[model samples]
Target: DASGVEAVALALVINSGVTLVKTIPLRRFEDAVRFGIGLSPVFTVFQVDDQITSSPHIAGPTGDTRLMPDPSQTVGLVASPGWALAPVDQLDQDGEPYPGCPRTFARRMLERLAGHGLELRGCYEIEFFLGHRAAPGPDEADPTPAHTGPAYGAIALADVEPFATALIRAFEEQGTGVMQFHPEYSTGQLELSVPHSVGIAAADTDLVVRHTIRAVARNHGYAVSFAPVVFAERVGNGNHLHLSLWNRNGRNLFQGGRGPEGMTREAEAFTAGVLAALPALTAITAPSVPSYQRLQPHRWSGPWACWGRENREAALRFVTGMVGSRPDAANLEVKSMDPAANPYLALGAIVAAGIDGLERELSLPDPVQDDPASIPARKRRSLGIRQLPASLTEAIAELEKSPMLREAMGDVLFDSFLATRRAERDVFEGQDPEDVVRAHRWRY
Candidate 1:
């Protein structure tokens, strides 16, 4: 019951593209519960240099702090000693919605969807790498990979059994369901599939899952990296989102008996909207410079803006259900995402884009039955398939010019997000590749 616990950690995802945590003594939990914790609004615009600034004039040293906790999200930390996670709501002093808040954006999107008689159900398929930190000393060697894999070989699972077993147990204790875990193709890489939940809960569960994995890895004397590409030469980690839409009547709106590939009209429009918006969506879903390193063609990171049935190489992969689940199990897997992205923003942008498609009644294009990159360049263009933004700078440019995304995220959020991303890109653009990886490898 953690009866002896002396503190609770309140975590918030800030505009800096990272989670900022504040620990309050247990005795003060009541005070927080009563009046809420004071937090500087400047945190929303903080850059890696601790500067509170953003483009289009968002620099602030005058706003008051507001941190309201969601009591329902409070959960015990089974992996970290004497710790607990309390997700907080960020707002302004006047109790108005903070345009910089990702969760606020997500809630607004959900509300918009509800207005259309639809709901979102989804989960994150997380992949990460475990490495061993060398002994602390001036002469310490570089961190060593935990396992060398033969690409999902049985031996790979046995190699990390102790850590994997503990991680699964901790996830269960923390109320985060684990559907499956396996070794990925890359060295030291492992993938975990979590059970899906609806809307905001799904994002909440993703935060818990990532936190649990990092905590459990630390407990085992290892370091875990959710960076998109841990090594330049190997397959990178991805945080793929599997999403489905449901109607108010409890029916899977994505299922259609007459639609192509068994996708309902609603699902088709939703997917078409997502595909159309993929170029700009890259700024949010694959938000880091290192993310672009992992999004290249032939790498299976959804390098092309196309959809295919069970195609890993396409940005959107439509998965068909098994016997027990049947049509209800069908969902769209967005493969161009990674863990560096804030789940709230990523999922929110996706829903908003899909809704835009639905509102406009957009039509789905023909599914790419083969590898998108394999097709000739001229032919690819004929099929309306285009390469995703290949760099963070390029992606941010698309995002900045995207009226749909700007409308979905609001001007304040959209501008601030771009400023933050631009700041990151400016820092990494001319830097050495190793230096860049070192800077972000452990942060995400």
Candidate 2:
């Protein structure tokens, strides 16, 4: 509640797969903070077409509203006008918990892990593109790339120095620790790595990171796109997750000399569960039609559901500890995620899968040492390695059949989530490839 604050933006992650924001002027923000803000329950079932209301929740003749407060999230918009994020909780008319709430699901998952004397520690490694807005064209596609050169070239980083500087400073002010920033393989593409945190804080930091980057880029007169693919022929963007587990006494549970690749027994079990559920998890982790375009072989987008040591092509890569960092630096990287995913939901599902493995004492498969694609097809099949869902339709079908994931997410959220994804599929199923990419280019 800074005196200079002019507005508070209440943010909610809705079923449409984007953060929905509602702004309140400074004068009214105090009241909103005290009394909470009113929101329609229909938001949980909102489709691309406002007129097409087909969800079971909407089948009833009557509708209801709820009032939930703006929880305390990272506050940093000092570089922009006086603005900050106001995160809200969705509830029922009687003020009961809303089943489709992503944050609630994440919290519950964290609690479940805690019950086993373990905690989740991780961060999202975000990749995105920066460019000018597209000039109006017959096809209405996004703008052309802002720069072109070798990936990680010094010239590419120098070209975006001003915007990058502002973004880093803004993130610092908001309490997000910037570990590294560099130009990526695609033209105008960049990647940012933030320091990891425990449990819910990691997702909260992801939100702050996205908001800070977008706001600072806007101030520099540049548009940032976190879409899976900004251009059809270029390398696509991915929001890879670096995950690990820890004990309450501050010990890294993923490190040990007894298991495969120097991993601990706990780490092996957790990784096995996530691999077992990779096909179903894809629908939630890469929730957009364009996301499938990025998950192909040889692009390092985790095309196959197999775990390997330092193998980028596998869905889960077991990262080794750095020379100085030792056991503390070890973690698993989940590469199938994209920016379009709701951080809370993606993380929640991941933790649930890991816990399932831990509880059931699941065993880890042998690690893939060579490039999985180069391995003979017969050998790959015998090794139990399988390709992930190549299309959104296939991913959705896999999710629908997963009894374990459905039970984890609960009936209310699972049904609503499926309905929303189906609606998205209906809208983009037959559209041109470039057109589909354009439609999702800036929304994330």
Error of 2 at 143 (Å): 0.7
Model 1, 305-404: lDDT tens per residue? 9999989899999897785685568889999998888888998999999999999999988999899878999999999999999999999889888899
TM-score of each: 0.95, 0.94
Candidate 1 residue 70 C-alpha distance from true site, Å: 1.1
Clashing pairs in 1: none
Which pairs of residues collide in model 2?
none
Distance from true position, residue 123, model 1, in Å? 0.9
Task: Name the regions of candidate 1 deviating beyond 4 angstroms.
Answer: 1-5, 30-34, 48-52, 135-141
Count of backbone collisions in candidate 1: 0
Best by lDDT: 1
Q: What is the lDDT of candidate 2?
A: 0.81
